[model samples]
Target: MSKANTAQFFESVKAHGFVRRSAVYRWMWTNYDDLSELLKEARPSWIVIARELNGIGLRDARGRDLASDNIRRVWLRVSRDLEKERQAARAQQRPAEPATSAREEPKRFNPSRLPANYRPDVEIKPQPSVPATSGPYQVPASIDVSEVPEFYTRKDGTVVHRTQEQRERIAQQRAGFEKETRHIDRYILTQKAK
Candidate 1:
């Protein structure tokens, strides 16, 4: 089944990024006629129009309700197109009358504003709150590794440990380790000649 036809959607979603705008244009282009009909019906309301779009699974790219402005833009375009169609039919069927003034020009239909306090009949359930328990981690008092000061050597033969004497011995034990480094680093390189 098409998402637009069956998926549950939010009222006016805030679409950002390319994906959302693409969805909007896709919905607009695909459902153009349906949207126009919704605008033309008696007792046209923006909220109702938005709801109809929602029914078709239209929403902000983020899956949230679309903003009113975005919905209004589409609504305005549909309503304007409808008006143009009506005017064209009138012009074609009825012969030309007196030269029309600017006021007579076919203007965009102004649908009544939705009631200020009006809200959708959606059941808004309170979001589940995470328990206020301590996070899944503990702050240790210190990272003191007092046991033996274990060490590891890097690929470049550099030794890392809690003491200089241990690092020196570890460095000498390796075949490719540099002796001069031990001298400069005061690691007792004298005893390990070659």
Candidate 2:
């Protein structure tokens, strides 16, 4: 690439927000036509191209100089991109054809082919609410005793059992929480009534 081309490549790279590796790909794509002509004339090796790229201060994504393998990989990608562009251009140049009866019809979804267990029409019923517990502990009916663990771990890295005193303290806290929630619920109900 020439000095002006290098300047233009950097400018394009900044404008497109391309990464270091992608910037090289973009540069290759932009100069593909000229590069193709040069390739046809000189047929230079990948090692020569790598050397030229390094000479021009063009580096890979890692900011290291390009190797023969790196150049070969980038060249392959550029060639593929150019071929795709050519194919697209050719496609655009060709006239569109009308749909014919000879063309196969698109497949339709068959609901009957679904598994026997599939029940799309079935209505999802809401679960029945558990009755509120009236015991001194005043534990929420939603909580299952079987699910609660017997032992608990503290932040200080100590394993402790749910002692009678700990249980009483927990029950007291739950009672206070229930009282506050009840007050809030009553206030909300009064506001809704208004």
Candidate 3:
């Protein structure tokens, strides 16, 4: 339909208060052309259209009196349906075309066209292979490392070692930790008793 006819049809839909998804909408679809012509001849407001619809025993899909909002929503839905129908018709009228050329062939790898820096005379050398061990490994009897130092010297020539006082403090902390762990174990076994 042309823009003018579409506008007329929408106006008629608004003026007639056709309910969406109801028997009235189906009826309107069937008599669209006649309604368009009638709308063009007489442009009525929503209130007048509602009164006429009520007089003719016409109501909305929910059996209630049609309001302006309901009529506007119906018009919107009808317009969308019309646009979709027009688009579908246009698509059907056009012919489909292929996207790619039928004469083109797939490309293959060409090694002869190597980079300028590539030298075919240079031979590639094989790397040395180490034997693979499969079973669980056995530990060495002993690892001798007497030459290894117990403490490392700093850049200022001072050895980093624990003092006598620090060693005594660490031993006391370890003893206290062991005592606390034993007490916790006993408490747990006795159901948290002191």
Instruction: Please give the distance, in angstroms, between residue 80's alpha carbon in candidate 1 and its true position after superposition.
Output: 8.3
**Candidate lDDT (C-alpha), each:** 0.60, 0.79, 0.65
Worst-scoring 10-residue span by lDDT in model 2: 136-145
Q: Using lDDT as the measure, which candidate wins? A: 2
- How does candidate 2 score on lDDT? 0.79
**Clash pairs detected, candidate 3:** none
Cα-based TM-score, every candidate: 0.27, 0.42, 0.36
Distance from true location, Cα of 160 in model 2, Å: 99
| Clash totals for all candidate models | 4, 0, 0
Could you tell me the TM-score of candidate 3?
0.36
> What tens digits encode model 3's per-residue C-alpha lDDT throughout 1-194?
99999999999988666444675555556666775676678976666766766677767777988776665566556667767988999999988656766866877757778787776786899987644534223112242223334444457854433353367689999999999999989889899454
- Of 1 and 2, the candidate ranking higher by lDDT: 2
Clashes of 2: 0
Tens-digit lDDT track of model 2 for 144-190: 54466754556785444567449879999999999999999999999
lDDT, candidate 3, at 144: 25
Error of 3 at 86 (Å): 2.7
Which scores higher on TM-score, 1 or 3?
Answer: 3
Cα deviation at 47, candidate 1, in Å, is: 0.9
